[model samples]
Target: FMDNSKNMDIDYKKARTFLDAGLTYPTGLGLGLKIKVNGNYAVNLKFNGKADLNAIMNNPRNAHFAFQFVPSGSLELASTLAVDADVVESGVKVSANLHSSTGTDLTVKVLDGYGVDVKLGLPVKKQEILNFHSDVFSVIREKTGSEVETPVKFNVKREDHGGCFDQLNTLTGLTVCGEVSVPLDGFKVLSPAYGPSKASLRIEKEDESLTAYHFRAFYDNKQPDKLSLEVLLDTPNSKTDRKFLLTAKGSMKPQKQLLIVMESPLTVPTTFEAVVIDTELEQAIAAKLTSDTAAYFIKIGAHISGDINRRKYEPILEYKFPETAALSDKGWIGRKGVKGGRQQQQSAVGISGAIYVEKNPGTAYRQYELQSVTLNTPNIKVTVDGTITIDANLIATDLKASYEKDTLTLNSKIQKLGERKYIARVDILPSKYP
Candidate 1:
């Protein structure tokens, strides 16, 4: 009977060693010796060796088995023996076939079976396999304008252990500061059931050096089916290294080897200077500019047009001239705080009119049309009527005025009143009303 138990442990040990040496399974090892007796007879001896599975596994070599035969007693043997190896080799072809769950494609080869020309029984259609890689590769390619096929070289040291983060949420109510770069700025990946929508930026920079990363998706109803990406590169020593903030909503399909699509808003790298809190004087100036009574009133009104964020506006203003009541609620034309009878009469005789603003499509300064009215004494009848034009700087040009049929008529006049403010006036009598 064969001594299977005696060397079983040894074979296992050797196999373990081979496994440690990176050799595959089912490897064999043995030792034998032969002695020549006269010319045609010989004595053979054999012994099985230990199998170190651990060693074979650790090694990078392919796993294999070895066997030896020896004659202990007197035996006669021929110098040459006819051995047909092809048939046996064809039947004993050692190989394996790997199948993937996803549709990813992969190619695998059997080491020993290669030279032997073994046949692989692969499925009619196979899934593809995605090559494992680090995320930095994609980021570096965009940031440095390097091609995707750029030869990148990196080594993992002995001290480095393999690690992974399955799902990360990098942008949870996070704030950005200083220079920062994000490769997947606007990638939107939608779930199979949910509709398409925009994707949010998943990475964020808290301070100058601190950064937080996340893999959470922004939940939305109108997710886009197509994929989108945005790359942010914050250059070193950039002047915009101040209080920065960004709000993005973006999506990701996790199907293996499948194309991932993301959606996001246009990535415009813009910096906003810190809003400097105005001193007491600055606040006072702003208040004075918009406060009541800061503006003057006349029969001729002022035309106003400029860029404002809101679409709705209702300005409440109070006029200061004493005779303004006549031009406004009361029927009188006199300046406020006018002392003496002559001065009061002169203030009452001052010009009064209405203002009109005409905005030029896509132009900076709007056209201002002012209607002024210097009431005739005794009856206090209307008199002047006209229009004026101004540029973006509120510069008045083409100034002309004419009194037609007892009514004032003015031509387009462009004039700069202030940075954005403009002024135009006209006079009109009841007969001129149209």
Candidate 2:
């Protein structure tokens, strides 16, 4: 008899024992013994030879015991029980399967097996793992030509502690570094006019408190028919508004160049400048520069082609004012006068008609014969029809100026005496239709 009690009361005389011996007591004898505790016992055995046992003894208090066993090449037994007791509260509880394990799995839980389940040794397939090289190469081939064989090298590191905030005590950080190549020829299908080029991209964080960053993208090409473009983005002082800048330059043909620059700021208006130059002609054929609050100026300059006489007689020309002028309801206005006096005059006058230029016989000076030109000032609603001749510094005209319901005919000769000084002789006929 085996007992763990300090006191025992039993009658040996009343005890009985029985046994049976088989196989004539010579060949074989079989014996079996079974014992059970009075508390709670749970045993789960599977056909694959895995065993799970959970037992709770009710002596003195609740005591838990559990274990799991799996028969495999790597034999391992795992405990599936956890005991928590509080002496001050005098609380007792029994929990089963608080932890479990098998040949390829181990799981643990707390708080009566309903909280914080942590699992380990979970099965994973090969396909579930990421293939870095293959994926990167596939993307590169898709962007570039399929014949590309560039090697991609990268590394990944896991940091145990990265960043933290309130209520979050642990953080994991993953850092990746790599490089990818992009062929410029791949984009030819999108824009055939662009020459062979290479592009570079850069990005940088400017501030930690604000969402401000600096970005730049540049594209460059070879010489002769060269092209280049750059873009920039930033915040001026980590406090001001964001700003963006773009500049583009291209030289397509001989002696021809193009330049463009644009700037945009969140607090102020945008500004831009564009120019197209022909170095052979030593001029810009078309140019523009302006801002939102500034005066806009545009000029188009070109050389007149064809017969010399026709070029001189029927020339097309453009003119630009030296000073910036403001556009108003009454047309462009010049600078304001001093002390509120008369406003300075401003005009953009264009003239086109048949005109002749001839050299005076035995004289170094030339004469200009204006055959027919009609000048009109739409803002003032006045029209002038004139035939004039300019010889040396003298201009002689016989012209008619017509206004609303009035026409005046004048025959005049004006001679320039000095800068801003002129002497004139005029004969004005009475108003014809006043």
Candidate 1 local lDDT, 119-162, one digit each (tens): 11112121122111122111112323432322223232112222
Provide the lDDT at 324 for model 1.
Answer: 34
Question: In candidate 2, where is summed lDDT lowest over 10 consecutive residues?
Answer: 125-134
Candidate 2 per-residue lDDT over residues 1-434, each given as its tens digit: 12312222322211112222222112122321211112222223222111122222222122222222231111111111111121111111111111121222333322232122222321211111111111122111222234233322334321122221222111101122222222234544233122211221211122333322345555667566878676765533445445567777877676455666677654344344444555332233544444555545444443332343323343233333336454344322323457534332334554344444555565545545554443435444455565566676788877776677687787888898999999999988858633
TM-score of predicted structure 1: 0.15
Q: What Cα-based lDDT does every candidate model obtain?
A: 0.28, 0.38
> Model 2 clash pairs?
none
Off by over 4 Å in 1: 1-174, 177-335, 338-434
Predicted model with the maximum lDDT? 2
Model 1: residue 276 alpha-carbon error in angstroms: 33
lDDT of 1: 0.28
